[model samples]
Target: MALLYIIIIVAFIDTFSQLPIIAPFAISLGATPMLVGIIIGLYSFSNIIGNIVSGYWIDRSGPKIVLCVGMIFVGIVLFFYSIVTTPQQLVYVRFFHGLAGGLIVPAAFTYLGSRKTSESKGRIMAFSGASVGIAAIAGPALGAIISGRFGYDYLFFMLTVLMIGCAVLAIFFVKELQVISSKAASPQITSLKLTKPMLFSYTSIFLLMFTLGILTFALPLKVEELQLSAELTGPLLSVFGLVAILIFVLPTNVLFDKWNNVHLMTIGLVIICGALVSLSLSASFIHLLLAMMIYGGGFAFIFPSTSATVVEHSGEAKRGKAFGLFYACFSFGVITGSFFAGALAVSPSFLFLIGALCLLLIVILLYLFSWKPVI
Candidate 1:
C-alpha cells in the first residue's frame, strides 16, 4: 500500500509538472505557435510506442525492473531538457523522453490493477484514483510555484530529483506482483485484439485522456490569452481534481463493487461533454474553475468504471498487454489533443466543441456495439 501510494505521488508530480510547459518551452525556442504541438506530440507518439514495448516487457519480466529503469531513464533525459537550445533538439529529446519515460506508469498501474483479488480490486483501484486526485490537488500548484520562483529549468531539475527518489523507492520498498507463471512462460503473443468491455475500456479512456491533452495544453495558453496570471492556471486546473475526490473517486470506490457500471459511465460521459462545452465558453477565472470541476467529476466516474472494466475483462496472463494497450490509447489521445489543440488554439471553443462531438459519436458507437445492454 505504501509503495503504491509513493509511486502515485511520484508519477503524478512528474507527469503534470512538466506537461504545462512542454509547449511553451518549444515556442520559447523559436518554434511557431503552430509547431509547438509537435514537440509535445512527439513525446506522446513515442510514448505510444513505448507502451507497446513496455507492456511486452512487463508481462515477461514483471513491473519492478521496468518501473525503476524508466524512472532513472526519464530523470536523466530531463536533465537534457535544461540545455536544449532549439525546437528540433527539444522535439528529439522529448521523443526520447517519452520512449523511455513511458515505461514507468503503465508498468506501475498494471501491477497495481492486477495485484489483488476480484472482491478487493475496487478498494485498491479506489486508492489509486484517490491518489491521482491528491496529486492533482498539489502537483500543479506546486509546479507553478516552482516555475515562478526558479524557472522551467529549475522545475526540470526538481523533477529529476523526484524521479530519482522514485527509482530508489522502487529498488528498496516496492513489492513485485506475483506473475501468472503460465502466462509468463508464453513468449508468443498472437494478437492484441480486446474483448468488448476491454475495447470499451480502451476507447473510453482514450476519449477521456484526449480532453486531458486539450485541457492541459490549451488551458494554460488560454490563461495567457485572457491575460491571466500563469500561477492561476494551476489552481484552476486542480479544481477538477478536487471535485473528482468528492463526487467521483470515493463514491465510485464503494459503488463499483455493487453498481451496474453502464449507467454510471454514461452519466460520466455526459458530464465530460458538458465540461468541454463549459470550458470552451469560459472567459473568466470563475468559469474556468467551474469547467474544471465538471471535468473532474466526470473523470471520477469514468476512470474507475473503465478500470474495473479492464480488470474484469482481462485475463491474468494478458494483464500487462491489456494495460499497455490501454495506455497506448492514452498516449494517442494525448498526442491528438495536444497537436490539434495547438492548431485550434486560435479559438479554444472549437477544440472543446470537437471534443464534445467526438464524445457524442463514441456514445452512439458504444450503445450500438454493447454486447450487454443491461444499463
Candidate 2:
C-alpha cells in the first residue's frame, strides 16, 4: 500500500512540476500565446487516447504489468523534453509524454479500487487524494526552484531517474491482482450505460479540471504580469495543495464518508466559483494565496466524492474501464480549458473571470435539475 501511494506521488510530481514551467518553456522556444496553449493542451489530448487503451489493457492483464510499462514509457519520454529545441518539437514531445502518462493513473487507481470494499471507499480515496495533494504541494515548488537554479534540462533528467526508479520498485514490490472468474455473473455486468451518479461524477471532474486548466495556463502569466519572479508561481500554486491536504488528513475527512456526494460536490463547485472570481480580482501575492486556499477547499470536497463515486458504482469487472473513461473526461476538460483559454487571448484577470462564469453555470444546472444523492 505504501509503495502504491509512493508511485502515485511520483507520477503526479512529474505532472505538477511541469505546470509552472511548461508555458514558459514553450514561450522560450518562440511559441505565441495561442501556440503555448496548444502545446499545453496537446498532452491532455493524447492522454485521452492513452487512458482508454490503458484501461482496456489493465482489465485484461491486471494492473501490475500496465503500471510498470506505463512508468517506463513515461520515463523514456521525459528524455525528449531535454532534447527539443523548437516549439514544434516540444509539441510532439508533449503529445507522447501525455500518452505515456495516461497509462499510469488508471492503473494505480484500479489497483486501489480493486482492493478496497465499498464501505471504506471514501476514506481510502481520501488517502489517495492526500497522496496527490502531497505531490501538488511539493512538485511545483521543487520544479520552480530546480529550474530556476539548475535549468529545465536538469529537471527532466531528474524526473527520468525518479520514474525509472519507481518503475523498478513497482516491478519488485507491487502484487498482481488475481483475475477472478465467476459462473453466475449478472446480465447487466456487460451493460455499457452510465448511471446518473457516474454522469454526475464525470461532469463534476470535467468541470473541476477545466477550471484547473485555466489556472494552469493563466496563473504563471499572472505572476509575470505583476512583475514577480516566475518562482513565485510554483509556491503560489502550492498554497492550494497545502489547504487540500489538511482537509484530506484532518478530522474533516470524515465528511467524505458521512455526507451526500452530490451535496458535497455542489458546495465544492460553488466555492470553486467564488475562488475563480477572487482570482480574477487579485492584485497581490496575498490575494492570490487566499483565492488558492479557497480553490483547495473546493478541490478537497470534489476529489474524494468523485473518486468514491466510481468505486461505489462500478463492479470489479468494469472498474478499470470506468476509471479510464472518467479520466478521459478529465483530460478532455483540461484540453478544452487550455486551448480555449489561450485562443480567447484575454488577460489573466478576464480568463479567471470567465472560468468563474463557467463554474457558476455548472452549479446552476445542478440545481435546475434538482439532483439527489444517488446512493
Q: Judged by TM-score, which candidate is best?
A: 2
**Every candidate's lDDT:** 0.77, 0.87
Report clash pairs, candidate 1: none
Residue 254, candidate 2: how far off, in angstroms? Answer: 0.9
lDDT of 1 by residue, 147-244 (tens): 87888899989988988888997888887776666544543332345767677778888888888878877777777767889888777877888888
**Lowest summed lDDT window (length 10), candidate 2:** 181-190
> How much is the lDDT of residue 350 in candidate 1?
68
**Model 2 lDDT tens row, 1-375:** 888889999999999899779999999999999898788878888999989988788777788898999999999999989999999999999999999999999999988888844547777888899999999888877788899999999999999999999999999988889654323456465333587777878998999989988988899888888887887877777788889999998988999989988788888889999999998899898988899999999999999899988877877767778888988998888877776787788899999998899789877886555465555
- C-alpha RMSD of candidate 1: 3.6
What TM-score number comes out for model 1? Answer: 0.86
Residue 159 miss distance in model 1 (angstroms): 1.4
